[model samples]
Target: MSHSIAHQARPGHKRSEDGVLRKLRPLFWNQEGRLRAGYRVIVFFLLWGYGPALVHGVVDRILSLVMAPGGQWSFGIWLDPVRLAVVVGAGWLTAHYIDRRPFSDYGFQFNRDWWLDLVFGMVLGAALMTAIFLVEWAAGWVAVDSVFYSNESSVPFGQALMAPMVLFIVVAVAEELLTRGNHIVNFAEGLHSWGHLPAVFAAWLLSSVIFGLLHIYNPHTTWVSTANLVLTGFFFGLGFVLTGQLALPIGLHFSWNLVQGNVFGFPVSGKVFYATSLVRLEQRGPELWTGGPFGPEAGLLGILAIMVGMLFTAGWVRWRYGDLSVGRVRLSHCENRLQGR
Candidate 1:
């Protein structure tokens, strides 16, 4: 059998036709059975790893909201703390026992490249959010109050900036490690030979969808919220593809959430906050655009914003790394693949 053919073999064994051990490519960067399994593993981890935490968090939030409506949704201050310690420590420990992948393979390495990726992610993430907010205003879906600054939530100058910074750093690192780091890479690598496009697209779609669905478990969720979250997954996935480093996607994810939750004071997706916000907006007008209970991110404006962000990141990636043409999609293949390292 041709090792070049995906599923030509199975896990724990590689079958090569001629003796030229075919190198394994990333599924998201290739087309192979490894791609299929790569996606399955990610969905599994998301369900197993983050699913329980999300569910418990939702239940707790519900109780808290009932007990204290104002401060109920604000547990993220502690919950969202930047735990570089956790990502490195726990991820290292997991690699030691449960998984065979090396710590560095997980995209946990701290280096100059890592920092640059982080910076770009933050700036781009903020820009995307800002762009979405502007669209909302133009649509006349939301009316701003002079008091609220822009109808979104706000905090004092001191806390406003710091809170989001912390949240972004923490959430970005952890989630990226789990989703796009060693985990996704391993899956992709195992499949890359059969056909690269199939594998890559599968990984992208599966991981992204799981990212969105996880949000549905939130205390206050609607179909629109789920739809917005699905788009969010695509946005983050594009970031991951554009900058193979997990750092960039993590940065973007953190910024988007922190801005929505703390800076803007609207529900981040469906999760609301009560902590000292940097700004506050009383949404008055059409529920479709203002996002009503689901928040702006769950609205039409959110869809447009994320789509724009996706395109921008894709373009940047193409510019920096020559386009790796595959069907209608064009991405920087080597840059998007972990093993391309």
Candidate 2:
């Protein structure tokens, strides 16, 4: 009735009311021709992360009762994948419909180079970890302990490799979706509304710190380890910000964990895992140098290794793309680049 009376007052009054509504409408959608990128970027994770996790929990309870352990019921072990997928899916939907952006804009596309990039990233990640291990061994910071759980699994050694790889693959994908996919890209663009390059740098710093915080609850947490994680996060973020494709970063994350725990039998950031044929490491030197129970990434050697990885990645991006800038790319652009290989 109030609306009707106000409308009846004058045709000129209706125009004024619409102007007010237009101003309010932007709270949900960016109608002012601004991206309001941050609002959209985190909205899905903030609002809907728990709902899916709750539903997944309930489903797992039912599955536990209905199926045999480590059979079809074993799917519960993969819950992280599902939990992270909910956020990724929500972001995808938002990007597709609300943002009206190509999927590639989010730094994803399955092309010829996709497999190569993934494999290369995996190798590079493993190599970096190996380098850290070798350096520590050479320096006598760590000693080669007895072989840990050497091929004692029901699955053969070759197949056992897949177990950790698969787990880390899910972890890598979920993290990429959370940080590089949602945080860095969205924050960069949103900050760009204020200034261009500075905005991107700010986003990089902010996301890297946030990424470090996310791991704070892990076992054997320390100031040194935490700081290393922050730096490592930045290192990973550089791969994406420079290449604008998450393939390298995703692979790096996956293999780093796989080799850290599954292959090398070190505490992966204070968390340990079991798998087939890999020698265990025992830190013998100063805790600060070896990271002690916290893992290599927390140690001085790990920090050195991470910085070197950053340099290598920067060099690779420079060689590949002439210059590294977070320029948006179309799906066709991604495909065209892959065609040569």
Candidate 3:
């Protein structure tokens, strides 16, 4: 957790004759003395994925040529794993081989606190979802008929749920890796090299904004919902920075959706579920308070709940790791390589 005070610039001043290269060095390279974080990030993604997408395109063309005049497989599934590998694989390779940096630098170390932190995040997420639902119900914005699980569709509810549950799990994994694990880590490393003390806010905002925008096209999305999603994204990102790994954030993301949509009888970003819950309620009116089809995530109550959760998480971080000081990461001469070994 020890890091260098990277933002500190040398005391001496240089004139224009110091050259244009000197001026440019401050922008591109980590002149403070570390491998350029931005460069590593670029190499990471390139290594993780360069031609798989084009390869997929070629496969589709071959299918069209062979199976039928115009037959083609779905391109969506192909994008899934390749995207995940681009981040997770790239991060692992960059840390272990190319950079020769410790896994802890990127928060990949799986030590004793891993499961403990993950479980804690899930519990907090579940509580946040529950609190929002309760607030809506108390305001009479939501009405409960009874505790019910539907099994009337083409697939029996009992048998049907495991897939969607698994799908949500996949979503949590892919998104956490893509945003918090890859993007934020890259930005943070770059910011650290620039000697930014509190890089968390900047990195978290960059990742969270993208996270919200990604969900902007979902069913029943609203401006309010997008903003709310951005807020939740911040909470999600907070877990990673607070704990320095993806486990806590992944756990929070998965549990929030499961409890919010499946257990609480609310639409998750617009998709409804019939999973087991203590109570089955229906939203009556007041779209803002109840969140309409977008679920409580788009509501004011949900916003308050997430802020409360963030406070709780902040407390947890203080209790577990002391103040939010990860300090600085130092690099040796040979440790600063372009490609990971």
Query: lDDT per prediction?
Result: 0.60, 0.72, 0.68
Better of 2 and 3 by TM-score: 2
TM-score, cand. 2 vs. native: 0.81
Candidate 3 stretches with Cα past 4 Å from truth are: 1-105, 145-148, 151-156, 273-280, 326-341
lDDT of 2 by residue, 1-341 (tens): 99898778888777889999888877755533544666765664563456556868877777778776545423534554665566567768766765566756767877766666667678889999998788778988777777745444454566555556666776788677667766776676555444545666787788889889988999999877888999989988888777677888898998888888877777888987543437766677787777889888898878887888888888877776688675532222322233224
Candidate number with the higher TM-score (1 or 3) = 3
lDDT of 3 by residue, 87-125 (tens): 466566676765556655655567767777788888988
The list of candidate 2 runs beyond 4 A from truth reads 1-35, 69-87, 148-160, 274-277, 328-341
Give the distance in Å from residue 302's predicted Cα in candidate 3 to where it truly belongs: 1.3
Clashes (backbone N, CA, C under 3 Å), per candidate, total 22, 0, 10
Deviation (Å) of 279 in candidate 3: 5.6
How well is each residue in 77-175 modelled by candidate 1, as lDDT tens digits? 444542445445656655544444456655545678667767777788778776666666676644554332322144445544454566556666766
RMSD after CA superposition, every candidate: 10.4, 5.6, 10.9
Structure candidate 2, residue pairs in collision: none
- Weakest ten-residue segment in model 1 by summed lDDT: 324-333
Could you tell me which residue pairs clash in candidate 3?
2-328, 3-328, 3-329, 4-328, 6-195, 7-195, 97-340, 97-341, 98-340, 98-341
Report how far residue 319 has shifted in candidate 3, in Å.
2.1
Reference-based TM-score of each model: 0.66, 0.81, 0.70
